[model samples]
Target: MSWPEGYGRLVLAQVDSTNAEAARRAPGLAGPEWILARAQSAARGRRGRAWAMPEGNFAATLVMRLDEPPEHRALRSFVAALALFDAVGALVGDDAGLALKWPNDVLLNGGKLAGILLESLGPHLAIGVGVNLIAAPGAGQVEPGALRPVSLLGETGVRVGPEAMLEALAGAYAAREAAFVTYGFGAIRTAWLARAMGIGAVATARTARDETTGTFETVDEAGHLVLKTAKGRVAIAAADVFF
Candidate 1:
């Protein structure tokens, strides 16, 4: 597969973490870059939770410098989610059971298939992605009440190696990124909600201090989770959503 143009690419046999590597290389990057690792010894997910990297899974980070506001930059999580959804669907040649969860997760057959994490590195942003292509942690490995993890191979019986997955993902991301930069988040948000799971359903958003239980309304233009509760409409800036 052809790599995306105007983007730097690197593949490592081993690394402490792709995101960490991105940070180390961000200062020297001339443009957006993708860092892929065969193995990561110190990987992490959102909220600094440990992220498991089984052999043959997909672990990569896209480091790019954007001159947008932090809020706009943060919306790239949705962009990444859409890219992952497209890439994986293309690989399996089907998207029947694929869906995107709020915040930063990609779901397959109602299970967590992949996750996206965004971190700031001075002027650059590191968008770390982890996909379960071959193996996934057991349900017990995740926090209680979290969605059970699933893998592409396990769910679809289609095996994809890290490099091949990166090619698809990078291209997909580049397309989505271009659209986002040109048309803004309006189109991206609309597209995301079309594939989003749990819209108009009752769900709960658990923040650090409180848990808000309400019907999943819609994701606002600012990328906040809008929920319709008995009290009124609430827009959650950040939270762990549960259905």
Candidate 2:
């Protein structure tokens, strides 16, 4: 299949972290490339959480040189989530219980099936993507407070290999990125909210200081999650959400 313009591919038998590899190699690298690893020893998720990517699961990071502004860079996480949601839909079908959690998470059957981590170095951003394809982490394997982990294999009784997932993801990302460039985050936000997992539900968002409980409202124009509590609308930029 044809890849996105300017994209190349790389595979590693093993790597401590594909994102770290991308961060190191992107500066010297010429164009975008997808770096995938069979196993990750030091994988990580948002907020310094240790991400457990077992051997059979999928670990991939897209390395690309980006010269966009800081605000534009911030929007990439949402764009990435939408792209990944598309990829998941391809495997599980659009009618499946695949939904996107704001910022960077994909939910399958109301459980987390994938995560995204974005790291920037100069003009380059290493967008790391980890999906649970063959299996989700067994109990006592993952960090606390992760959305109950689920896997495509467990949900659909089918094992879609990592290579095929990557191919679909790359294509989906290219298409979504194009739409983002042309129409901006407004369009992306609309599509994301359509497949959003929790909009009317009550959820708690814990920040560094304290946690706030509210009705999960819509994500605002700037992409901040808008929560409606007794004290009007709370615009949350960063928090761990629990439903």
Candidate 3:
């Protein structure tokens, strides 16, 4: 695959976490960069949860400096999700079982296939992505009631190396980035909603202190998840969603 133009790339045998590596290099970067780790000994998910990075899985971070409002920067999660949807769809040669979950998760055949985490490192924003391309963690490894982890190979018999996955992902990300920069988030939001899963269905969103059960509605202009609850329509900034 052709690497995207104007994007820097680094492949490592291993790392503590690709996000950590990006934070170290962010200050020196002149443009967007992708850092890929074949293995991560101390990777993490949101809220400081440990992330599993088995051999052959895809672990990488995209670091870039942006001059925009916090809300605009936050929208990159949707941008990254769309890029991943495109990249994985290309691998499986169809979009049959692919769906994008709210906040930051990719579903394949109704199971969690990948996850995205965004962190602000001083002046740059780091978007870390992990995909189960070869093997998924056991059901016991995840939280209770969480969707079972799934792998591309196990689900579709598509075996892809981490490096190759980065190539496709980077190219897809570049295109999505261009769209976001040019047309603003409205275009990206529409595209994301089209591929989003579980619209008009009942789901539960759990936050730190409380849980809200409501019918899934569209994501708002500010990227807040809108839900139609028994009380009224609610816009949630962040939550763990379950259908």
Candidate 4:
């Protein structure tokens, strides 16, 4: 019916985008609500890429208000990414191959397993998370070194559902949210880098403006993607990362 604590719950059969629903209903919401759906006809990933999510997979958005200003609240993406890591780890057992990508992507066995998208709503925020649980889309023609889409069922032969993921996600997020509030992003950054993929490795980042080739450096305290390019260490606040 509802989450144990922190977030309220609204499960839908289908919607355009959970984030869109969150934005529409965020004003009337009391505190926080996990807006989940079985299928999304218009799921959008980073860079507005069309996310092909079938009925078996999970697509949800968590709507909430952050008193902290937008700049600071943006750091919550790291927190949510880490929380989902913990949740997936709990389901499949933590493995060395599983890692977090820069910004907000979760990788499994070197493939893309999950992604988190944060959309700001003035003082509020919409944290959209998508997980490949039962079914995964084909790699379809991706660039070299690009991550292929993977699903838990394909990787572990285990079938997890949105209901189970929401429970574990809420619990995992509570702890990480507390750590973020108490200690700050510095603490979270350390843990994130520990499980980060492609750090210290040569990679390329494509932003809206330009693309830069460099070594994937560390993320800053403010959660910017740090890169070691010919121009020296550059902090990218927003970009699509690739290796």
* Candidate 1 per-residue C-alpha lDDT over 1-243 given as tens digits, one digit per residue, 9 for 90 to 100: 477899999999999999999999999999999999999999999899999999999999999998878998999999999999999998899999999999999999999999999999989999999999999998878988899999999999999999999999999999999999899999999999999999999999997799999999999999999999999999999999999
Question: Candidate 3, residues 1-243: lDDT per residue as tens digits?
Answer: 589999999999989999999999999999989999999999998788888878899999999998777777899999999999999998779988999999999999999999999999877999999999999999888888889999999999989999889999999999999999899999999999999999999999998899999999999999999999989999999999999
The alpha-carbon deviation from the true structure for residue 60 of candidate 4, after best TM-score superposition, in angstroms, is 0.8
Flag clash pairs in model 1.
none
Worst 10-residue lDDT window for candidate 1 reads 1-10
**Candidate 1 global TM-score:** 0.99
Which regions of candidate 2 are displaced past 4 Å? 143-145
Cα lDDT for residue 93, candidate 4: 78
Structural similarity to truth (TM-score) of each candidate: 0.99, 0.95, 0.98, 0.94
**Root-mean-square deviation of every model:** 0.7, 1.5, 0.8, 1.9
lDDT against the true structure, each candidate: 0.95, 0.86, 0.94, 0.86
Overall local distance difference test of candidate 4: 0.86
Model 2 per-residue lDDT tens digits across residues 31-89: 88999888899999988888888768899999888898866787788888988888878
Which ranges in model 3 have alpha carbons more than 4 Å from their true place? none
lDDT of 2 at 81: 91
TM-score of 3: 0.98
Q: Top model by lDDT, which number?
A: 1
How far does residue 83 in candidate 4 sit from its true spot (Å)? Answer: 0.6
Q: Alpha-carbon error at 23 in model 3, in Å?
A: 0.8
**Which residue pairs in candidate 4 collide?**
none
